[model samples]
Target: MVTVKMLKPYYIKTDNEHVRIVLAYQYFSIIIQEKVYQFIPIEANEIRINRRTQKVENIDAKFAFQHGKDVVYLTMAKLITLPDFLQQLHSIAGTYYIQDENELNGNSSIQHAVLIDELERMNILRLIDKALDERDEKSFYELVKLL
Candidate 1:
């Protein structure tokens, strides 16, 4: 059974207010003021951002985040690569943290590790299904708006 732990949040300062970001395995949850947003990691064919315009263009996904309005946008503006992501994490926590799943879990057996990987993927799919099932009309429309 896979259990999700409540991990510590990385607080970052934005122009408007301080926001808390919690990164789970393949997902990240953003806490802005009293509201929280949960997002799945979107894979893009090529993720490009114009820093001057504060516009992000992901070829695979149709999501637009303007600079100042979204705290997630502000934080993500800096993470263009793996090294950048690690640097940001280290800067926020004042320590180095790696997101290497195999190293962290210490799964030595190949077959056992594959099973674990499959289980984790299944779990994410299940959670997405649950969220879709429980979503209201407005929430559903909001997701559609992203397209």
Candidate 2:
């Protein structure tokens, strides 16, 4: 999954009222909105923003933020190179806070995480089945909308 705030390094992503991020892989992501729209390959980047147009380009900061609690990785923007990602983790491992303890599922954020994980997985399956079966994106999207 992906977060909109995390969208800045790529194209201009609005819809700020709600956002979510998940480490679908070590980097790449799928972003869904209001349980309806979905976008993929949200990468991390070092960027220069065009204030007037609200566009972003020049990705350079892609890396993983890791802790015992969770790990955060970026993909779509391609901000940081793989080497940079590893170096950052090495440097931050000592000074940065890494939550290496058990995950707590008490907070609403955690609950949302759980919900997204389950729903995204189901949605992915649906997307694959539809694509293979020649189902329409509209129907698949609507199914996810309800989900």
Note the clash tally of each candidate. Answer: 0, 17
lDDT of 2 by residue, 1-147 (tens): 333322222322223221122233233222333222222324532333332233333344454543344455654254333444334323322232222345433566688999999988887776767865886767667666554
Model 1 whole-model lDDT (C-alpha atoms)? 0.40
Cα shift from native, residue 118, model 1 (Å): 0.2
lDDT of each: 0.40, 0.41
lDDT of 1 by residue, 1-147 (tens): 111112234333232222224333324333435455443333321223332233333323421222244524323333333354434444444432223577546755766889988987776666556658987556556555543
Candidate 2's TM-score: 0.21
> Where does the lowest 10-residue lDDT sum fall in candidate 1?
1-10
What TM-score goes with each of the models?
0.20, 0.21
Q: Residue 75 CA error for candidate 2 (Å)?
A: 3.5
